[model samples]
Target chain A: MIQLNISDIQHFSVGDGPGIRTTVFLKGCNLRCPWCHNPETVSRDTVTLTYPKANKSVTYGRSMTVDEIVTEVMEDADFYRQSGGGVTLSGGEPLLQAEAVAKLSQALQGHGISVLLDTAGCVPWCRFEAVLPSVDTVFFDWKTSDPTIMRERIGGDLPLIKSNLARLLRTDKGIHVRIPLIPGVNTSEEALTAIAADLRETGAKTVALLPFHRLAVGKYEAMGIPYPYRDTPPLPADTLRRAAEILSPSFTVYAEK
Target chain B: MGCIENFITGMQPPWSDGRFDTPRFLEYVFNDGKGYFHPSAGLNTGTAESITSMEILMERLETQLRAGVKEYVESFNRINVLPDPENYTAPFLSLFCKDCIGRGLDINMGGAVYPSVHGAALMGVGTMCDSLAAVEQVVFTHKDATIAELVTALKENFVGYEDLRSKLLAAPKYGNNNDFADKYAVWFVDFLSEEFMKYKTPDGGGYYTAMAANVSNIYAGHVIGATPDGRRASEPLSDAASPTYGRDTRGATATVLSITKPDYTKVACGTVINQKYSPSMFEDGRRDKLRALIRVYFQKGGQEMQINATSTEVLKDAMDHPEKYPDLVVRVSGFSAIYVTLAREVQMDILARTQQE
Candidate 1:
């Protein structure tokens, strides 16, 4: 009867994972990524986002038991079976509530549904161990490679994240090391190569370069906070391709739009 | 004003056998209240009866075209080409219609202000399109079965040919935005409109096509045999102009895209596209998406769309416990009715509509 702070459950989410997945965004993140798209989930307290133009308000962060979460996500089991898609436990770093996630994943797996975990890999290794048994795939996000930027700018512990990624790479689960290609943060050749080296050291074989987009401007506006990257243009397609090129020599890279 | 009002008041026809004494000739000629000349009867191209009726209509059109438009119009005035009687609730003028009654003329006999245009309500656009696409792909392209085998299966209502029926069912169906199947729908509207346009009504009114079957699709489906699209005999033929129920697996966007492929300008009597969505989609923020979708559908030349926001779970529950949901309203085709009051088959038909997420 463990309860998890849930933000929102999005069904038929094609971009979250393979097939038609339902993404469960857990509330509260340990790290503060300024350009985070889902800024509403970064806080542990229940937050309401009001949109003036849309004349609507959406409140996130509800306490739902593992059984309730399972029942809700199970509604799309037929779609999952047809599309090879299942449930994706996303963040606010799902590893922050590893125990509830473990229970929910186990319940979904018991129903013959696959479970995927999308994490920033900034939490303790013990948190990863709690959910590792039920998760079929791990989408580990590797942001900037510099320790100073990771610690000061992004508010993440670089060594801890690297250790977690290295350990996750050793597991039998499907691992996808994803890099958010932010323009000033990680688009430079030096930054890309450094990330490539870090991932290579972790024994990662394949990487997906996700281009930075400004789709979160509205989310920030709804939260009544000015996004730091609001004025910044999206990463050009050529920039993503170049990042892919820099990482290609070390590993098989996928340039995602 | 008083004289006109008095004339209107005096125009009520005498009651005979608990019915207005309207023209029995027109009713007898058009086979009123019977399935003999139902507008949908000739539209199900899968049946031999439909083919024979279509041939007769085509031959008549050929003779009229050979005689030329001027002569055809003159001849139409002399001999009334019977419009589908279902278009009028009363075969003659209404009991209180002053002009037609004063002129001693039925409404269809050049009595009204405008000439009567014929609306050949093509019963099942989705069924016809799906059947054609399935026949093309399964029989001709894939060579999985011969025409003889398919006809035999259809004749037997797919009793022993479950495998072949499965192949037909698996073919690209209409309303998926897949042009392989959608092109046939486009052709259905265009070809029928062109043919109907070739002939004029009795009073020189143009012939128009309609996809608005209303509830008559249920009745029309009762007579239709097994279709090439793997529809069982006597099953409801894809409500109105919408895709076959449960066959539009793709979401609402693709459904709208496929439905809008047909040039609706030709469908002067209009078409009805029924779509169902969960109740959450009708909320304020999410409702904008539905509005955007509908706007795009209209921009792409879609005629009409009827959306039902009741979720399948609630609908099923209402069916099980009708007394609890006495006021639950649902859109059945182009109209709305209380959920518990609708016949079980109609409720089942509404439930069968794919709920686009």
Candidate 2:
């Protein structure tokens, strides 16, 4: 009888994980990253996206039972089998609904579908422990090593996030540390070096550096919020190369451009 | 024979995927066919000229087509009777210059030239551009080998070059929603459509183009050499309007985004955007996502979409057990037919289409 607040269920999502995954983006987040691409999933309350360019709007946030969620994600069961892909739970922070998501992941896994959890790792260790057994892989976001920027810009508790990542790393679950290379936010050499040191200590194997894209500019417009990165150009290819050079020594780094 | 005519007439490979060249074959359509000089020979016109003369000659070709069309119409009318089959249909493209005349001199956009069938469109630039990015990334950029070595390897059909081929294949492909390769596809569409737009049909109809090649990508691939996208020699080119089979690694959503990047509004003849989803994706709840995906695509100016819900399993079953699937109909390009009736290779080709969720 448990219910989860879901924003949207994207089928055949390749970006979230390996193969053809169905990414269920749950609503609400603890962080407030200014350049958060999926702003709609950030708020727990239902929000409508009005696009003046297309003269249309779309509302996010729907309540669905665990059975309904599992049924929806299971529709691509064949794709999951053929492509080695499965269900990925992504959101503003999937760990925020740790209990419900743990049940959801277990349900999906029960159907022989691999479950990947994509989260910011800002939640408590108990949340990670609850979902770790059900999730086949964890895409942990490592925004910045600096605590000041984390708290001021993104409203994240660096100590808490780091502790959760450290705890998750100790487990047998497959883990990938994702770095969103936001220029002027976390692309600095010093910051990347600090990140590399932390991830190296945590025994990180693979690191995916996601370059900043302006794709979410429209999302901000629809919500009537003035985006902070409106005038900011995308992270240049050279910057990505430089960042990769810094991160490569500790882990097998690749650019997700 | 039409290929030979295109060649004898100095037209470059004007067929789907610029593979056919001026024929070197000596076979003749008529007794006097061998006697006529190649169009290039006439362009020389016994004149020593450079840039200006070439420009002037280029301008004269259009005029020549207009004149020849005029003479053909006059002759056809004079010789035709009430019962003449030619008079009824007036098949426009069989005659030389009709394709160009229909676009340049003709006013109607009704007739279409042989456009780049989806898979063969990359042939426009040959293997150079498509493979150039990969070569740059794998060999040159990575310092894996020199350009000369890579060229030699390509000449050898990548024999003993398994590592290099894999690296090239790993390079971003056209339909993977990666801007690196998809940009070329966008340019291919825009360049061809824009070029055709310059010509008008005789009836003032605008020139239209198509990416739908039906099954010609298979035939076209037979003549093309190994390409840079790591496609082996004699491998089928991407079919219909879809990307090279299985090259769209990002699944259906990304493929849709990449395929819909071209301005279909400029293409009056329409294009076919093919997607194959497993049978399960067509089920009640999941079918709505496919519909929404298509709705999003069309809303973004996509002209046409051709989706096949038949899974590879069903297709393979149909192949092995034709008696069991008498009514199993599958869409092949613009039309649908009994699955059992199609050629095995074609059936296999449809079977290989990347089936998504």
Candidate 3:
């Protein structure tokens, strides 16, 4: 009986993950990454008239019933057959709505469609395990390796994200690691190399490089939240190329626009 | 360079002799809306019925021409010709007519070009400044084509001479961002606007302008028949094929291009403006750019344009995630197509090009 809040669904999408995909943008997330382009994904409630005046950056989806979510999942059934594409659950964090994701994914798999879940690695293992059984692939965003650094940006226990990631890998669930290249925040060569080495250990072969962009800065104004990292410029292209080259030895690098 | 200028001026190359000699027909076309055959007479796509009030503008142009308005046409090229070695045509005009002209604005001057399969096709225009070297390459340097022979080739569709056709097509056309392309683009636009103002539509609509000339006429073959220009009947339409050419020229050296605005105007009687977005205007981003572009277009003498901005995101989701947003519409290349029915590549391409502007 759990519900889902989804902002938008995209089919024939190539940028979100490997292969063509129908990316389902879930409505909420538990994190508050200052640089998140989709700041709308940072909450759970679809519409809240009033609450304690908190950061407007936090927004989630309207709750939709499982049948409704499944109806959305089956929209791209034809796309999956031709492009080898599948559905990818993305959001503030699909894990926050793991029950809805599992329900929808299981429904899709029943009809022979492949499913993928893209998350910020902030949900519980029970949720992850629950959805993993039905989903075909998972892209776990590993923003920062440093616990305190991660905690400063994303709410929730860092230990929980690390453990959930490890669990997915230990179980050999379809999982890929993703890193956003921020200029000063995570550009240390050591940071790249360290994450690469850990991902190499996890049997996860690839890491997608999502370069930080200034496009979402305006969205922050609409949400009425002071951008936490105004001085952090986007990573210069060459620096990221170098980081990719540096990490190339340990983990397969996938660059996206 | 020496003779192709005639074709450039829209004279059929001599190669085509007795094609449709619509002198009276063409004269009527140039008369604008006042002419008996004016498309707007009964069509009435919200355009003015007459331009009698603009006699002053015509007199000024005539005086300027007679006084030798030596102003430089701020263009990368003037009268670009996409090489149709095969003498075949492309479907660009027909497509524009059938697809882009949904509401029937009566301004889309479809090319004389027909469709071709052998050669590559081109589209897109170069940005323009003012330059002479650019003008020479665009207007002058070309194979010496007799109006008769060119018309014959155009009319005959390059039937017997595959070699000549191949050699002709081998001539490089322009596109992408570059100096030559840009220069030719400016000159070509100015020339057309200048020339078009000389004659009104049969109904006497005002002169048309605002042509986003393709750096080269890759799609020229779409209308490739011999034109009244003495060329064959079915020749390709150049990107410079818009009705107005030089109307945007501010001085002898600089050009001012404008986007059309939504408000009704008397000048848009016979012009075409290039539209780039769709949801807000039928494009997802918004209509500010469209409004701006159209405003500029109207300011610079544009008579026609197209739009599709139905927010591809809405459409993309309906297709990829139908449950996300169940009902959304998108403007396809020419017509409105359901968002969910579009190919993913098409959807992504639309998204990639979507703008906040």
Candidate 4:
């Protein structure tokens, strides 16, 4: 069966995972964050790749074997070693293609290469359960602890996300909670303290502070869609630093990549 | 003028198709009595008094260029501000070209204290020079009688000298690559730069100047007259004050080729050569061999490159097929031109290079 539906494969990225990682953007997403940069990934169905100059084209990927995927990735393995970066599996949600993610991660791991899985914890717990053994680290994105805000910004099933978090905590995998602190939206003093508290409760041990940015504005124009969070300003760098310092005492809060 | 009889004479096809031949060009330029004549003028000597920021240069250049380009478009717009100033020289050169081609104006370029023109030449003078310069020389050098007669002729407005004006306008100038001339031009510039850039500025601003001169995007050249060498009329040159094109070998080569110490140091010497083939050869994968040739160029101590990077069919199509992409900018050897605006033979050279496949 055609298992993996990838949106993009970006190279020479310095701030994705550990170092310079090749972040593979898989196509279908489960949650819809208002400030999402890769909004194209949110839909489960395949769509045309659109350009801002009024051009549109089809996506280019086929169902390849685990070995075929590994071969494509290893071409830049030397760059990974030099830069202390490896492969970061991110997407609509890598967990959406759980079996493929599991197989691909294990293949890369068997080759002694590092792998990172970036996810929004709303997927079925069994999906993460299958991929956990191979993934070196899981960047579990958790935007807000307040269930109402979570549902409003991104159509999130917060209780299920928290429960999935609880299950991951029970296991021996490394996990970090990624909270994007958007001012007037999610970046309140209360949200920081509350997220710090929820992360501590999850026993995740690390929470990364993700800041908002305007880099995704062009993508919205390209897709011919009005971005709901268009007017939302980026969380100032100083504020994130201050928030990181504020939340540090609770659970090793660090800035998100 | 005394060495006129002693210098060895060479045969030239007095009639030209007006494409790319140096001897015909030389014969046409030297036909009658001329107002300006200098065999050996020193290199890189001018009067820009070395002001350091691009801000001041832009303020002064913008005013003059607006006047030069007033007749072209009805009104100025925001896009005309041209954030990219480096590509402005050829356009400026085009303005002087249109003026010289439209009237008999023997305007001397590369003279006096206009820093903007010097700045433009430093960009890439090889492609853009001779065309308009030839026209200016044509008007000033005609069936004249005495020294006073020539001087008086120089003062006449382009409209008064209608016959010479039309002849001047009728001639096409160089900006496109012509092998024999571009090669010789390096020698002429080398001669001028060596002798001219010897002393410090009269203003104590050292004579050593390396500036990026394409200041505006108006496609304008500078107005020069009665230079030390003998530029007598309002010679139109580029006023777009920024830098030169194709990296000047010196700027591109990691080493900063400046006039700080020894002048006219050979940094990265590059020239536009003639290619006989057209686009059909390259489209069939001749570019691989061309790429390999460049690899050898770097290996054999050559560095840096910028390509016209389009196919000949497209070039031929652009010229013959002008209705297709009117805004196509192809490298006319050193300078670039919007393909539709280029003359036929210039378009043919581009077609030949695309054949390198």
Question: Per-residue lDDT of B67-132 in model 4, one digit per residue for the tens?
Answer: 222311212222223224353333333333324334432112211122111101232232233322
Colliding residue pairs in candidate 1 = none
Assess the local accuracy of residue B285 in candidate 2 as a C-alpha lDDT between 0 and 100: 46
| Cα TM-score per model | 0.49, 0.48, 0.44, 0.43
Q: If both were scored by DockQ, which would come out higher, candidate 2 or candidate 3?
A: 2
Question: In model 4, which regions exceed 4 Å deviation?
Answer: A52-65, A170-172, B1-357
Docking class of 3: incorrect
Who is ahead in lDDT, 2 or 3?
2
Q: Kindly list the per-residue Cα lDDT of model 1 for residues B6-72, writing each as its tens digit.
A: 1123333211110011011111212222222223211121322222332342343233323333343
Model 3 is docked with a DockQ of 0.02
Cα lDDT tens digits, model 2, A45-130, are: 99999987765578999999999998767655755665667888998899899999999988987888899999998877888889
- Chain B TM, every candidate: 0.72, 0.65, 0.29, 0.31
How would you encode candidate 4's per-residue C-alpha lDDT over A42-83 as one tens digit per residue? 776655556746433445344566676686666556446644
State the C-alpha lDDT per candidate.
Answer: 0.74, 0.66, 0.47, 0.48
- Cα distance off (Å), candidate 1, residue B7: 27
lDDT of 2 by residue, B182-235 (tens): 665665566555655554333333343556656666665655455556877666
Say which candidate scores most in lDDT. 1
Which ranges of candidate 2 are over 4 A from the true structure?
B1-357
Candidate 3, residues A55-170, lDDT tens digits: the string is 22333456677687666545434335544667788877888778778888888888888888888887667888789889878888888766667777555576777777777887
